[model samples]
Structure formats: structure tokens, C-alpha cells
Target: MGACVGCGGSQSPGVFVLEAGTYARCDGCGLASLDPLPAEGAAGALFEEGYFHGGVAGGYSDYDADGALHEANARARWALVERHSGAPPASVLDVGCAVGTFLVEAQRRGAQVAGVDVSPWARAQAEQRHGIGVAASVEEVAARESGEFDVVTFFQSLEHVPRPDRLLAGACACLRPGGLVVIETWDAGSTVARVMGKAWQQMNPPTVLHLMGRPSLAALLGRAGFELVTVERTSKLVSVGLVLHILADKFPALLGWLGVLARRPWLARLTLRYRLGDLVTAVARKPLAVVGT
Candidate 1:
């Protein structure tokens, strides 16, 4: 009933339906998106303090509770960036940088890092706790420092935005020549997504606006003036408590077990690092010749 976020083409109903809304796939680009879209202020409301503590739907349960696991996840992602790009960037901006965990890791690696998040709580925490420059949104960051960053990252946050193209454009506008744009997001075209269909945990509506595939993602980056570099599946190191917290949402029976595990500090701290293959990390670069173009 609405135009697709990926291609602006007519959309057909998708296989999933949640309490929030129905989803549809684009005939042209095949990106699945929520229909009717989220009300203007609705999406931002999802990132409040309640989001990290499981008070809100489609959000984590106690995101800050596992500090060591979060840092390990950030280190894994930073390793991926170094493997693909081969150097520590001079400056970096992280979009949707909740609590600045990744930016903290980037700073440890000698990158000057700034972050933007919709949640004031997150922004304040990033600035106060991590000492990173934090703002309310990418537009706000662009206003103060356009074309000033050697890297722009959207780690597991792009699909949550209502306008991904606008987000990418703002990131591109903030990058220096030959700078990189790194994205970690759900890949709807991946084997796991195809096999799991509507039951995929990433299909939560309203919170997740678009499910991007590799081809659509490439087209979007190209349109935003980035040349594709690498796109591949990436793994994360997550605590057992966090994984159980997420799974408990879809499978309520797991809650009893999760509750038991939560009381056990040793078991809760266990970390798993494995590739699920449904999520992808991509790197793209702005050409050196097109600094302002």
C-alpha cells in the first residue's frame, strides 16, 4: 500500500504481521518494510531508558548489564574494520551510538570518535561516561562538523531508521575524501533470513523499518556517492544473559530458564562468538577525487 523505502516502488504484502504493523516487500528492490510507517515521534520513543531494560518492545533487556561482553563485541567489530580497511582512521562518527561502546573501542585504537543517538539518555551517557562527542542526531552532527570524519559507522542501527537514504546521505556528507562508511545490519537476502522467513528475530516492526539486502544496500551506497568495498557476514560476542533475554521475547517458555540464568553470575557472563549469517557488515568508500562532489 506504500512505496518501498529501498526503491520507491509499489509494495506487496509480506509474510509477517506483528502487533505494531504489517510488513511488505518492494517489487523492485525486495526490501521488506513496515506499512503505514511509524508515527513521526514514535520511533524516538523506543530508545528511552526503558529500551535497554526490556520495558519497551523490540528493545534489549539490560543492555548495559554486560559491560565486558559489550566491549568484546565492539572489539570484534573494530577488528573487522581493520581487516577490511587496514588502518586506524583519524576521525570517526558513529550513528545510533547507544552508550558509545563501539566508539570507546575506536578511541582505544587511536581514532577520534564522536557519536549521535536519538535518546538523550544515550547521548549523555556517551559524553559523560565515554568522553565522546555526542549529539541527538546525524543532522545535528553534520551541522557542526560536515565532511570532517575519516569513517562513519552505523552498527546494527540502520534498519531502525525511517529514512535510510537520508541517514546515508548525512553520513556521506560528513565523510572526508576516501573515507569509509561501515554498516552492520540485517540482510534479508541471506540464507538464514530466507529459511527463517517471518520468524526471524530481526523482523520486529516499528522498531525496524527496513530489512536491507546486499543488492539494495549497494544501490543505496552508490546513490549516496560511495563505492562498494566489502560486504560479508560478521560475528559478535554476546553474553549468555543478553542472548537469552532476546530469545525470551519470541519464546516465552525460555523466560523461566533465563530468569534462572540471570541469578547465576558465572553462567550469565559466558560469551558466544559465532556467525549467524543473516547479519552482514559492509564497507564502502567515498572516492578521493570527489571530496565535495
Candidate 2:
């Protein structure tokens, strides 16, 4: 990695390796990224049905099956945005929205919600599930209207993008003056990340390019023309079913115990709240006034 996507800082590659991918760190900002990052917008083709249903290309394993957990997490994230905005947002956008799970929840709450997902299946699902018309990207949404949304969110999506800074600037362009942007991604600099070292599950690359942290993410927000508001730990409520699947994947040796847990079908619907520091959220606001345009 010669340059950082988060802050455009110079980066040194070969700092480390995690799961068959070489890692690099920004010399100026300490942002870790995949060396020779994957092509931008490459994640589009990886979001089809198989991606969500079969865990293709590091995608989810039966994403829609976790609707309860998805809705719960969505509600939590939206509540955070509301707390910062002090009210329900007039309009909201979620970038890289796989199937509008979050937007459906927002729609139920009476907010005009929109989304951007490159997958045709996801786009159709968004409209069918919640009547939310999805754009291919922020540029497509900006083509129709700039400064149109009150809030924009990147819930667990930014780290996977090849050019986070560019996408962030586009997100800023989609926001009205002083609008808020909520970004929630994994933290590579957290204590758990350090302790786990290379064993950290999120360290997967090509699928995950940037290993974002509070300082690096703050810098990314600042460079994208946003004022840093707050950074905090965001909890994810994952169903026990998903947990068992992860356990099976990571520790095959525990299959005996995992099979026991999987035998209880009710556990599939049971959700566990994880308030891990490694999962971080940052909310930023566009400036009310610009010095130059």
C-alpha cells in the first residue's frame, strides 16, 4: 500500500499478514489496509443472492434469515442517529445497503428512506421489501439531488470499499448543510484486535481493505468535509444461529459442542448483544458554511 484510502497518506506495505493477505499501515495516520487493494466497485458483483445466502466472497450466510437481528441492529443504529440529530431524520440514505433491512425499519418509523446497493437483486429486494428505491451508488443519488438527505449511514460497509475517501466525499455531497453521517465499522486498533493479533476474524482482506480505527476514521471524516461529532462502541445483536455458524467456521474442533447448541432450534431466534469495543461507530456532520465552493 503506497497510499491510504482513508486520508491519502503514504503507507508502507508488508507491515504484517492476516489470512493470506499482506497488510500495510499508513505512515502518517496509522490506517491499516490491504496491500495492492482490490479494484474499486469490485464488491458489486459479489452481492448477488449467493453472496448473502451462501457466504460467497466473504458475504453473509443467509443474511435475510437474520431479519430479527438485522432489524434490532438497525433500530439501534437509527436511534443513535436520532440522538445526534435530536429528532427523526427527514430523509435518510444507507450506502451499500444489502437488502434495505435498515431502511425498512426506518420506513416503519415514517422517514423517507433511500439506499445505494450495486446488486440488482438487492435493489429489487429493497423496493419489494420496503418500497425503497435503491441507487447504484452515491453518485447516482447525487445525479438526481444533491444536499437532499438529512442523514446518511454506512453501517458495516465502508471498510470493504477500496476508496473510502472518495465514497465519503460523495456521501458528503449527498447531505444537506450540517447533515449527519453515521459510519459503523470494525476497529483494527482495539484491544481485542491487538490481543487476537493475526487470528482476528475481521483481518480478512480483498474482502476487507481498510482496518479502520477511531483516529484514522476521524481523519477520513475530516478529509471528507465533515466535522467529527462522536465515536463510540456500537453493539450488534447477532442470533445464536449465526454465532454457532461462526463457531463452526472458526473452531471446527468445537463442532461437538456447537452441534449441541444447534440442536436447540429456538436458539436460532435467540439474539445475543455484543458491545465489543472492536465494533466502533462514528458520527460526523457537514459544516453549515463552507469557506470556498
Candidate 3:
């Protein structure tokens, strides 16, 4: 293992191994990242059509299957954004805005919203289904609308980025002064991760490149000219059927049983919202004035 990506700390072997890759933890930042990180295009490959439908190991069982549930979750996230930064930002940009669920909710709250996703299928769905402007990358959006956004979000997408520093820099460049950046990512220092150890379902390779804790994340935000506002754990609502389906992927023998339950209309519709204290939501603001400039 080399120096830590988030913080230049001495690296030691981690407790988990996935797909022949070893995860190493940094003594300085507590980020557990895959050694010999995935290739340039590996992250993009995970967002294909089969990812949402469970053809892949680290993806959702049926992402689009729970439309109402997803929209409800999106609305809840929007409420959080409003709680921290106030309602109806002048403009919002969603990085890795898969299918634009959050973008739609932001629009509903009266923000001019746009999104960018690496997956063509997702981008198309965001544009055609939600009628929101979707681009392939922040660079593309910046070409047209630089420093014009009031809020930029990375909802469950920052962990997948190979270079988070670059991602934050690009986001900062695209934001107006005092703009807010919202991030939701898995925390490596959480109790659930410590308890599960290597068996944690999220410790997979190629899909999850980095696991960031609050302190490391705050430092990253500050380096990119953002002031950390809040860091807290957030809950997500997932269906019982979806949970079973995800479990089935790891325990193949349970697939038959889980499939049966997943088909039951009532069981499939049951939703639970709980905080595992493993996921962190950090809200940061770009400094009102550039330091030393």
C-alpha cells in the first residue's frame, strides 16, 4: 500500500479482501481504500443497466422498481438540505445524479436544477424522464455555466470516485461564492463497519474505492475552500424485499427464498428507515472570499 489518498498517512494492511484486491487503512485519516486502485474507467463501468437490476455484485437489486419509495427518499434528503442551508437555492447541480431523483425533488422545491452522471443510461433517464438537463461530467457543465450554482451535491457518489480531491476541486470551481456542497458517503470509522470487519457488504472493490470518516472529510472540504457546516449520520429507507435481494447476492443459497419473498406484493412494499450510524452526511460551504487572493 502507498500513502493514503485522502491524507498522506502511513498505510497498513486492512482486514478485508475483495475480488483479489486488498483494502488498506491509513493511520492518519482512517480511510480504508483499495490498494492498487481500479483502472481509470472502472468506476464508470459499475453504473451500467445491470447495476440497478442486480446483475452486478455491488449494485442495487432493482433501483427503478421502487419509484415512490425513491422519490420519498429524495424528498427527505431535500428536507435535510433545506434544514441546513435553507430552502430553494438559486441553482443546484447534482454530481453523479443517477436517474435524477434528487434533482426532481430539488426542482419541486423551486431550485433550478441540473445533473451529471457517468452512465449514459442514467443521464438519458434523468433528461428524458425528469426533463432535467444532464451532462456527462462537471467539466462539461462548467463549460456552459461556471460558478453559477448555489448548491452542488454528491449523494452516495463521492465514495466511488477514484480521485476525490479532483472531484472537490471541480465542484468548487463550478460553485458561486458561499455555495453549499452536500455529500453523503460511508464512514469507515462507524461502529457497524468496525463490528462487521471484513464481512461488511460495502467493503467491495471497484465499486467502493474509498471510505471517509468525518475528520478526513472535513479536512478535504477545507482544502478545497469549503467551510464544514455539519457532519451527521443520515438514514435511508429501503424496502424489506430490497434488503433481502441485496443479501441474496452474497448468500446465493438464499436467492430462491428471497426471490419468493421479493415477489410478494406486500412484503416488497414494506419500507424501513433506520440510521446504522455508518453513513455520514457532510454539508460544507465555499468560503465567501478566496483566502490570500
Candidate 4:
């Protein structure tokens, strides 16, 4: 990976060369990313409907771990809600919300919640299980309603989008004034990333379109008309999901059981508190007034 000639930064073989290098760290805001995105078709193919929506079945784990992960994620959403409104936002949109865990929690907290995901399977499950409104694509959802959301979140999902700038812009357009855009993603500058080097799970060149640090993220958010309201390095190591993803990929036979183990009370507590393998959490807000509002 090397910088893109256009950006004078490291570049990767990915088709969208925002910069050079396997990843590019934005000097303006500290966002690091996989530049030269994988050929459009190749990357899009990886997210084939089935891979994301269907056949997830037993692959997700049996029971306890599933609940634990969902509950933990809910807690994260609740925290964001508190930061944004000292309470839940009246309306919310979760981009790439898998199975609607966060949206469910937000609903329970009194927010009128909706979610958008590309995976039909995931959408079905979220609707059936959580009773949340679901859309097949962000554009479709955004087009249906303008300035409809009080809070928009991309939890571990922003990195998957090909053109983050466009995505963020759309999100900005979808949100009402003073709405919040909360993003939770792998921190490319984390100690785990440095330690793991190329072996880092997020370094999976063609898939993770962008690997952002706080600076880069802030810059991107600013470019999209958001203001950095809060930024924190999650106490977690940021390696946990990557560890699980790797195990699932490299050792499929062990995936199911390991997913179960991930929920072990002892293991769960250790992971959550000790940062056994979590990463970064960031929150930004669209100002109640845009430049020309």
C-alpha cells in the first residue's frame, strides 16, 4: 500500500484512491483510510445480499452471547442519546443497523426509530424481531423523508461505505437541525492496530474502505457539515470484533462455539470493561444552523 498520487498519501490497490498507502491518515483531521478502493464491483460483490442478510443462522452464535452483544450495544446507544439530548432523541435513524439492536433500545427509550441496511436478511430479522421500520438502502430511506431524524448513527458501519463523504452528506441532509450523527468504528491509530500491523483485522485491504482515526473522522464530519461534539478512545482494545471476524474467517468450524464463548459472563465482563477488544466511539452533531440556514 502506498499513498495516492492525488493526495500525496499512501495508496492501496482499492479502486478509490483517496490517497496513497495501504491506509491514508488525514493530516487535516486524523482520519486514516484504505485508499485506492477495491474495484467497485469487487467490493460491492463482497456485500452480496446473502453474505450480509441471509444464511446468518447459527453462524451468529446460540443464545447468551447474542443477547450480551446486543445489550452492550444498546448501552452504547443509550450513552450517545444521553450525550446528545440528555435523553433520547424524538426520532432516530440507524444506518446499517444489524438486527435492530440499537434501534430497539432507542425505541424503548421513546424515540421513533427507523433503520436502513443493505442486507435483506438483516432487515427481515430486525423488523420481525424488533418491530422497527426498515429500508433496503439509505438513499431510499432518505428520499422518503427529508430532515426526518433527530439522531443518525453509523455504528461500525461507516467504514463499509464506498464514498463516505457522500454518505455523510446524505446523512446531514436527512437530519433535522441539532441532530446528532454518532459513529463507532475501528480506530486505525489504536495500539492494537499498531501492534498487529498489516495483520490487523481492519487492514483487510479491499473490504474496509476507510480506516479512520479521530482526526480524519473529525475532518470528514466537518466537511459534511457536522461539528465534533465529543470524541473518546473507547477503553476497549478495538481488537475484539476483528478477533472474532478473523476466527470466523480462518476457522469456520470453531466460529459458532467461539461466538458462544464470547458471551461467557466472565469473558464478557472482562472484554467490556478491560477493552478486551473494543475500539473508538465518536459523536458529532449537525449544528441547528448550517452555514446558510
Please tell me which predicted candidate would have the highest TM-score against the true structure. 3
Computed on alpha carbons, the lDDT of every model, listed in order, comes to 0.82, 0.83, 0.82, 0.66
Give a tens-digit lDDT track for model 3, residues 1-293: 77776766787885467654678877877777788777655676678888778677778777877778889888888888888777668688999899999998888888898898888888878878978768888888888888999999998888887778778888998899888999988887899988987666677676778878887797678777788899998988887867786677666788898888888978877888857899789999988875784
Model 4: per-residue Cα lDDT over 154-261, one tens digit each: 887888766677778889988988888888888776788777666555665455767777666776788788888887765422124334545565456997987786
TM-score of 4: 0.74
Clashes of each: 0, 0, 0, 34
Q: Residues 167-274, candidate 1: write the lDDT tens digits.
A: 898999999888899999989998888887766778787688888899879877887889999898887777776677667776677779777877787877787875
Given candidate 1, what's the lDDT at residue 253? 78
TM-score of each model, paired residue for residue? 0.92, 0.92, 0.92, 0.74
Candidate 2 residue pairs that clash: none
Top lDDT hit = 2
Can you tell me which runs of candidate 1 are displaced by over 4 Å? 39-41, 261-263, 290-293
Q: Which ten residues in a row have the lowest lDDT in candidate 1?
A: 36-45
Error of 2 at 224 (Å): 0.6
